[model samples]
Target chain A: MVSSQSGRRSRRWKAMHDLSPRDPHAGALPYGKLNLRRNPFGELEADDWAALALPAVDLDDVARRLREPGFRVQFVGPSGSGKTTHLLALQARLPEARYARCDSGRPLAKAAILLLDEARGFPRGGGSCALGVHEKIAGCAMTVELGAVPLDRLDLIVRSRVERFRRGDGPVPEVCLSRLGALLERHGGDLRLVFAELYEDIQDAAM
Target chain B: MPRCDLTIEFDQGKRSFAPGDAIRGLIRVRVEADADCKALKLACAWRTHGKGNVDKGLVQETVLYEGTWQAGEDRVYPFSIAVPRGPATYHGHLVNVDWYLGVRADIPWAIDPKAEEEILVSWPEGERSPDLGPAFSAPAARRPINEAHAFVVAKVLLLLGLVGGGGLLWEAYRSLGGKNVSGAVQYGIMGLSLAGVSLGVAYLLARNVLAQRTLGPVRFEVPRQYARRGEQFAASLGFNPVAPADMTKAVLKLKCKEEAVSGGGTNATTHTHPLGEWVLAEEPRRDLAPGMGVSLAGRVLIPADAAATFASSDNRVIWSVEAEIRLAGKPDWKKEVRIAVLP
Candidate 1:
């Protein structure tokens, strides 16, 4: 399994090498924005995509999870945590994808995958609504997150509201949280168990 | 977190005292825990309340203590403030003395907490000495009468001219028997009436315009109460020294008139009356404009010890001493006065 992991890493590195600039790390070093290409709403011109540096994430698995129906995923942690990286990686891997910021208590409609990065910055009980979107596109190759996610592990124990909704333990609507949990579990890959532990800590903090 | 408390006290119970007293005080500060601390400063400030008067208020400030204290230590700082001598009154009264201590912190964006004590001062019972002898209590300031006088005179004369013209028109209508006057006699009468109106208007305009250009509008203020020439002085008399306090009850009245009207000092004109052919030269003359108040200015050099009455020359000019209750308006003391003999 270790050799396979290394092989997969090598293959990923090789695939990036096939492009003009082999060392994706050059683009990855959070100098400015890394991945976001054109605006999702097609508002941006073609040349706007600066560069792309994909992190290790189970993109196909994330797609499958999103396809399961009623898909929802929330990214929670301090600023610059890998939550955005994971979500954006999943977005790029999917065939049909839509991106939006979630706020207030509103339903996520028509969107195949509901990815909310920086969920902690949003107010509590604002419901779920993306008040406005600048750009959106259909029939596109992939949409990348335009910023860096820190490599450091987030001490997710502080996010109590997230954990409460995850275990079916709190007054969360059964439909929304369960779907979000399954979606998170799908893309979480090796980090799934760690997320589970952090989720438990969050529950304790809430209690 | 470390905390510090400060307390201050003054020895002299009074804040403002005689110029020779020493301001005694104690300042104490108690710190709760051991910590890096900075210096403490004790300051006594003196500031005037009503500054920028004809006589400006004075200020004297002094710094009494400056040093540092160890954490968890209580320290008492003692100091004194000195009052200077002379005609100077602290502020307007005697003195307003306030003292305070500031404990500075090493951290930026933090203000040093301070303790303050405010006190009033006392002066010697008889020490109040104002520089000037009572000229008169400031007169009841009058609403400026210059513009108003011009307006009134113009309206009055205009009304008089209109009335005179109406009378002449009535006479002409009756004499002409409803037919328009067609001869030289009819023309002559009309010409005379027109000339009369013009002369009256010209005189009115000249008087007002000259007054405005020369000494400006004269100010006449009748005292509310007027004491006869031999009436008992100061205490025994019921007269307002500045302006008549009881103007409604004043015995004397005020009247103004234009006389010896003419233009001079470069701009001069001579015109002959149309009906009488009397040639008059418009010479510049110093006289009150009609409807304007009288202008009076004199320095009464009374013997420093007693009040005295003085007489004025040019007394019989009938310069109307009508004790009317008109406002004196503002006075321009800086403007030179001819210093005519007192009436």
Candidate 2:
């Protein structure tokens, strides 16, 4: 069982010109005051998958859980608990693998390495190393339980995202330890909701 | 796993560009370890960031290099990109449009090596801006369509009266035409009652008769249709009453929103993000006497940093004013008037 890198924390912000090409603020913010390029936690585009900052779980462990020829690896977690992100990061590493997000009452599609997200009760796809990120599924061969994210874990995740969009060696807006505690408490460890609160905070406070 | 490092640099030092301009750049690559590159691509594009779902467009793209690379090998691919017509770059509270020069090395059985550098597109100040595109008008203005509503109400009433009158004529000529006068009269009254009910329903649906009955004409003025950012624009609103309007207060807001239609066919969704808003006026009052409604005058300054209105084939940033009059015991009066804000 591979463990997440909890001891390592210091990740340096990249340095660039004062007004580097990354500050997309039309003419709003003066140059890059805080080295802010784009909001790291904003909506994801296709290319954005390469920089997901999943510091909490080791992707290699996830890959290990899906190697068997006809295995079913279910990931049971609440909404916004980094299930889809885990699938996406793995798909980035394994380009040929397919990733599908299940909608309201939609059937699962077949793939070599099927990374299914938001699955309904008890995913039914048999064989083909299906890593189902589902809800309310019972014990299985391997179940990666994503519980409420801790403050330190959240900090690492934020840093990985901010690293990709750094404007310069300047500071990056981060969810402080104190603030993270409140956010986690208020949202019941829902990372998506926490990010939304932080997103608004940065937008409101950014120059 | 196979791996490669991708880096991009523009020939020009300044990243700011205007529409129709071309960017000359070089993509430098280094393969740290052995890797089989399926394909390498360089692209110029724009994407929106902020609270809304991301919307993006690839302006230009080309395949740069492909095939295997030995360890410690360095490669350079120089190219030029013709920038697309405007949506330029915008940064607002709920929306931010950005341009980028991205390079990627797609590798099989390995993580894709990718790098992206943001760029600036400056326009709206230079050219008139991009085309408004097709299916364009979303109509930001909320000026009651006063005349159209009036016409609809009058037409509905006239139709009801005409139908009811025909029934009445039959009833009056009952003795001359039919022997069943009582039956004909009952039928006429029933027709009249049905018509009267429909008339009320029509007025309720087509227009706000309650508002008309309580207050006089509601008027708003934006002196100039076109406005430049960082400039002051004068707007005045006047209200008169037919009877004493049981109103509490009136509020006015000026907002800029980004509209982009995403997906297609039946799954198409028009995502509207209200980026920034400013309260131009909010006056509290108890009530207005008959023919004694209030008049308001104010100057609204388009923030120096505000994103000017933008429109492209599939996107638009619209500016409009919304007015809401709160009534003590009646449905509030609301209106939205569109205005043009140039970069």
Candidate 3:
């Protein structure tokens, strides 16, 4: 009887030993190794200002003009061109400014400093408004035409994000940096596309 | 400021056509002041627009008028172009293939003013054009090698080795009979060999009984390539076994998932989320003989709240039915069929 029981135990041990070669972390990221609290590239709330990589545009001049009552300024750029990022950053500096959608039915007459998004949709009216649009609108006190971020700036942005997620022990691999540069060129310096591709590469490497 | 207005109108007052159909349109231009016009051009092209990068193919182009135009010049240019017999129009979540007729007034020292109107192109009923094959091909099924034979062979060899070693040890024990010291040593050796042989046999039997069944190819039939949300559908599965075997489990499942591409450049990320799932069958098991086959049919209800199939440049929502069969002591046989869920 003892021999039979021992044999069963030995068989079970062998089965378990055969299964041990599989990766326990397959399909899941090794978050503990990277030492990150959460994915850094995920959607950011208003307070998550630290992750914002502002472009080299003159934010000071735009902010100064926006502070004045009845002063109209417009930020024009294509989608994913950091128009919203700059707008959000400017909003952080000027708390009194009101952010309003152009199509919203709400009354904007009483707004002291109106921040209108999708400026092309806004009706022509009297008020000091900061507009965000894909194309330049006529009659603005100042227009800042935003374009794609430069490759050098994009590299720094990628490096900073990686550093934020890096565990202190291991140096970031050279392959990752080179891959980021190649991706930047392929995507024409579109920062959003660059970051998304980087996040996927990191996850694949972890796998 | 110089002013120019361009308008495009389809001949039949409709903007839909099929392959080999001729697209006829009129381009009207009205100018308010004398302008150094580079050219008045009409172009027909198909382009994709959505979350993905833009891709365009110019089908044809014709110049309506070139050189200069005077003030109060108003002219109408009519055009007729035969649509290609392929490249059917498609509308998806992140990608759209659309044909357009555009008129551009190339003006010197200013932005070129242009007007464009979209037209739909489709294949005729029950027709499959060769050009649309790559764009509309069905997803390929997954196939992986079966390694059960290798596993069984290894276990059988180990069992044989244990039995042969045990027999050799027993012969040695019998050679040294009746001496107290030698007997004790021989008895211990015999007992160890017996234990090893018992363990090997038990393992071999358990593996043979639990994991050695061979499975055949799994095939599934779904109602249509696309289903509307909240629509009820039927799906069936048929499979053949290489030999008669006992099936421990069989099931079919319907699942919807969303895949999105986030980030840009070399650092793009693709993320997936399971939107909904339903089990069509469970606990289906049977014992069969060699060459025996099984077929199962079931009705599938798409949840009313399920997200409709959507595909953009870097994002997609996909729905599929999975057929899984598990045999006693063998790897599971699994197959999947993809279906699009429309809103």
Q: Pick the candidate with the highest TM-score.
A: 2
- Backbone atom clashes (below 3 Å) for every candidate: 41, 1, 21
> What shift in Å separates residue A17 of candidate 2 from its native position after superposition?
17
- Per-residue error for B253 in candidate 2, Å, reads 3.8
Strongest candidate by DockQ: 2
**How well is each residue in B1-343 modelled by candidate 1, as lDDT tens digits?**
4356777666644344555567677767786644344445554432211101111112344544444556678877676766543222221111111122223334223435555543333345334332111121212332333545654676676666666666666667666775656643474477467657755664554443343333343343333222221222111111123322111111222221111111122212221111111111111222333333333322112122121111111001111232112222322111111111111
Q: Per-candidate DockQ versus the true complex?
A: 0.01, 0.20, 0.02
How many clashing pairs does model 2 include? 1
Q: All candidates' TM-scores?
A: 0.25, 0.67, 0.42
lDDT of 2 by residue, A1-207 (tens): 111211111111222213333434423443255566777666666556556646345777767656665566666678678766777777776665677666534455656677766665434555444343545565456677888898888878777777766676545655457767777899998887887766665554453
What are the per-residue Cα lDDT tens digits for candidate 3 across A96-202? 77765554455555456677766574445565677878888888888878787776666666556555544334444222345556776788867667656554443
For model 3, report DockQ. 0.02
Docking class of 2: incorrect
lDDT of 3 by residue, B54-162 (tens): 4456467777778776779887888887776445555433333557777788898876879876667765543532233223334443333234664565566567656
Of the candidates numbered 1 and 2, which has the greater DockQ value? 2
